[model samples]
Target: MDPIRTDVDAPFGRIADLIALNARQSPDRLALADAQDSIGYAALDALMDRVAAGLQRDGVVHGDAIAICAASSVAYAAVFLGALRAGVAVAPLAPGSTPASLARMMRDADARLLFTDAAAAEVIGAPGEDAITRIALDASAAGQALADWLPPPGTRPFPVDVQPASAFNIIYSSGTTGEPKGIVQGHGMRWAHVQRGARYGYGPDTVTLLSTPLYSNTTLVVFFPTLAFGGCVVLMPKFDAAGYLQIAQARGVTHTMLVPVQYQRLMAHPAFDAHDLSRFQYKFSTSAPFNAALKADVLQRWPGGLIEFYGMTEGGGTVILEAHLHPTKLHTVGQPAPGSDIRLIDEEGREVPPGEAGEVVGHSSGMMTGYHRQPAKTREAEWFAPDGKRFIRTGDIGRFDDEGFLTLFDRKKDMIISGGFNIYPSDLETVLRAHPGVADVAVVGAPSVQWGETPEGYVVRRDGHAVDAAELLAWANAQLGKTQRLARLHFIDELPRSAIGKVLKRELRELNPS
Candidate 1:
C-alpha cells in the first residue's frame, strides 16, 4: 500500500500536509511540470517553504486573503500550495476577466499581495499605484519577480496548526463589475473533493494534464486531487487543440479535466484519432453544458473513461456521469453522487416529489462556508428543509427520472416566458444543432411585443456547410411546438465564450438587443 494512499483515506487531511508527506516519502518523484520546466517533490517542497517564509517575512498572516491573477505556471502552483501550508486563504482571480474586474476582485478579497505573469500583465497594468505588493510570476511583468522576492535558501516559516474549517480559498463568480461573489470554500470542503478522487483513478503514477488556467475552480477540482494523491501535474499556459494533443501524448498523461468546448474542438480535430492516447485513464468535463452528440462522439472515439461532473464552484449538489460505464444514459447528467443530498423545489420553496421538473437544490459535506462578506447573497442561495438542513440552490431547472437520473433544462433565469408558457432555450438550441450545418448555437429571449419574450438564436456555421439562417430557423420551428418557435436566427463566425468555455449568452443578447 502507498503511504500517500493511507493519508488520503483519513477522515480529513490538508492538501498542503499531504504534499509535504509525499515529498518525504517520494522525494525524487516528479510533482509538477509546465511547457518550460519541471520540478521534483523535494525541490517543490523546499520551494513552498521559501514561499511561505517569504510571505511571513512580508507580513501576510494566517487567515488573511491574498490573490493570484495569472496564467498557469510552475511558480503559480507553488505559491498556491505554500500559502495553504501557512493557513492563508487564496483568491485565484481569472486572468481572462477585464482588468477592472481583476482589480475589483483583489479589493473584494481584501488581498494586499497580488501575483501576475507576463501574459496577464499586458492587461492588468503596472502594479505600484496602490498598497498592493505585486509579485510577478515571470520576468518583465510589473511586480517583483518571485526569485528576488523569496526568502534565503533553506528557509522555513513557523508551522501552522491547520483545522478543517479554516478558509482554503475564495473563488469568485462570473461578473464584469460590482461586488464580486467571492465564495469562501473551507479546508473541509476541499478535503471532501480530494476524498472523492479515489473512485476516479488518481494515484502516484497518474500524470494529470491541465490545459485550463490556474484561476478557475473548474481546473482546481482535479489539480488539487492529483497533488494530494502524489501524482504529477502538467500545465498548459494556453489551450490549443494541436498543442494540447502533442503534450498529452509526449507526457504519457493519464488524466485531464477539460470543459465541454475544448472536448468539442478536440473531437473535431483531424489529428485527434492519430494521437496515441493509450495511456489515458480518465478524462473529465465540467463548467459548461455538454452536448449529447459531442459526448457520443467522444465515447465512440476517445480512449479511457470520460466523466462529466455537474456542480457549482460554490460546492453543493454534485452530479457525476461516467459516460464510459453507462453509454445509454448520455442525455442525463447521471445520478446524485454518493453522500450528496439532491432535492427539487418548486417556486414556492416547497420540496417537490421525484419525476417532476423543479429547481435543483443540493446538500453535501463539501458545500462552501458562504460567500465572502456577502451574507444576504449567501442566504439568498440557500433553502432550509423541514429538518432545518441547508441546501444550495443550483439555479438550474431539471427533472429526475424514475431511475434517479437527471435531465437538465435551461437555467431558471434563462427560461423564456412566451404566451404565459415556459420555453426552455436548451430545447430550441438542440433542434438548431441537429441541422448539421449549425456548429454552435445560443438561444436567448428576445423582447416580443406579441408574446412578451420569444426565443432568438445566434448560430455559428460548420465549415463547408452553407445553411441559410432564415431557412434553418424555419426548419427548427417546424419541429417545435407553436410556443417554442424561434423569433430570429443570426449567423456569426463563433459563439462568444468565457475563458472556461461557457457560452456568453449575455454578450449575444447585447449584440442583438431587440
Candidate 2:
C-alpha cells in the first residue's frame, strides 16, 4: 500500500482549515445542527473565525494548550477550531467532570487557558488560582454569544507553512490506573483518519447523527467524516432513546454510530418502530462487541442499515466489519481497513495460523504521537516487523479464518485461565447475551477454592422481564462446555461503562470481590 500523504498547502494547514474551504464551496449548505437550531457552512466558518480573533485578542497563541469545558454545541466547536486557527492546542475536558479529575488533567496537560459554559463553570469553576486565562460562554444566549463577544482587529493568523506533525489536541484515555495519560494527536494523524473515513461514503450529501459525546474519540471519527465532506453533523445535547430516532427521522440523517446498549435502548422505546428509518443509509456500531443474534436482528429488521467496525483509542487502530460478512462470519471484526496492516502473533512473536488465537498487532499512519511523552510505554507498543514495517501491538487477541477474515475472540489482557483451561469471556458472553431475557451481559473470572478461578456472568434483564438463575444456568451449561459455562450469576440494573460505552469488567471484578 502507498504511504499516506496530506495536502497541507491546498487550503487550511490542518483539519480546521477544511472549515473555511467548505464554507466557500458550499456556503449555504447546512454544516451542523443541534436540536432545532442549525448553521450553514458560511455562518459556521465566519463564527469560528470571530472566535479565533477573540482568542488572539486575549493573548492565546500557538502551542498553548487551552482547556474547553462545555457541552457539545456549536460554540464548543467554534472554540475548538478557533484555538487551532490561533495555533493553540485544545484539551477538551468533559463538562461535568469532578474537580479532582479536572484539576489533575489540567495540571498534566499544562493547559494555560480555560473556556467553559455556565453549567460546567459551576462544576469546573473559573481558572481562579491556576495559572490559566478564563473564558466563559453565557449559556443564556446559546452559542450566538460568541458572535457579539468581539475581538480587536489585526489578530495574526497562524503561519500557513506549519508542519503536518504539529499537535492539534491533547486527549486523555480512561486510565485503568485512575490517572489518565494524555494522548497527543498531530495534524498528520488527523488528516489520515479523516481521509480514511471519507473513503467510507462520507461527503457533502451525508448527514451524521452525533449520538455520542463530543469528548469521545469515537465522536471525532464520526463527526469529522461529515465535516471533511462538507456535510451536516446533527448534535444532540444528550443521548435519549426517543430523541435519537426523532432527530434521525426529522433531519433525514443518513449515517450514525452508536453503542449496542444505545441501540438496545432505542429499540426498547415505544416509538422506535413508529419512526421511519428507511432513509437511514449507514448505521455503524463499536465500543463493545455485539452478539451475533443482535447483528441478525438488525439485518432482519433494517435490511442493509448495519455495519460493525472495531477500533481502539490507543493507536488509531481500526477494523471495519464488511456488511456482506455479517451474520455469516458474525464473530469477526472484519478485515483491516485500506492503508492498514494487521497480524495475529503468539507469545514467541511468530505469526499464528488460521483459527489459532493470538495477539493482534496493527500499523496505521493515524496512530497517536507515542501517547504524549511516555517514551517507555510508546517504545513497548511499537516494534519493527521482519519486513521493515513498524506495527503497534493492539493488546487484543484474535484469529483469522481460512477465508482471511479476522475474528476477535478476546482481549489478551482479559483472558482467564481456569484449572489449566484457557477461557475467553467474549466467547461465553456472546452466547449468554443470545438468551432472550438477557438484555446485556459480561463474563469475568471469579476466584474459586477448588478450580482456582471460574467464569462469572453479570447479566442485566430486559424491561419487565425476569430470568431464573438456575434455569438460565441449566440452559447455558447444557449448551457450553463445562469449563466455559458460567459458574455464577449476578443481576444488575446496568453495567458500569466508560464514557465511550465499553463494559468496565475491571470494576465488575472489583465489586464482586470473589
Question: In lDDT terms, which candidate is top?
Answer: 1
- RMSD (Å) per prediction: 1.3, 3.6
Candidate 1, 64-100: lDDT as tens digits: 8889888898989999999998888999988877888
Candidate 1 vs. truth: CA RMSD? 1.3
Off by over 4 Å in 2: 1-13, 125-127, 140-160, 324-327
lDDT of 2 by residue, 1-514 (tens): 2111233223233666777778887899998878646789888777777677676666766666778777888767767876777677778887656877888888877887677677876776545554465565654422234535555333345443345577778887765435677787776767766776655677678888987877777788777767866778888868888878888888788888888778777766877778887777778887777666666667766534577877666554578886645558766778788767888788887888768888888877777776666788777777567897777787788888887678887777678888989899988887777788888888888888888889998989877777888888778778888778788888888998876677888889998886
Q: Local error of candidate 1 at 172, Å?
A: 1.1
Stretch of 10 with least lDDT, candidate 1: 171-180
Local distance difference test, per candidate?
0.89, 0.74
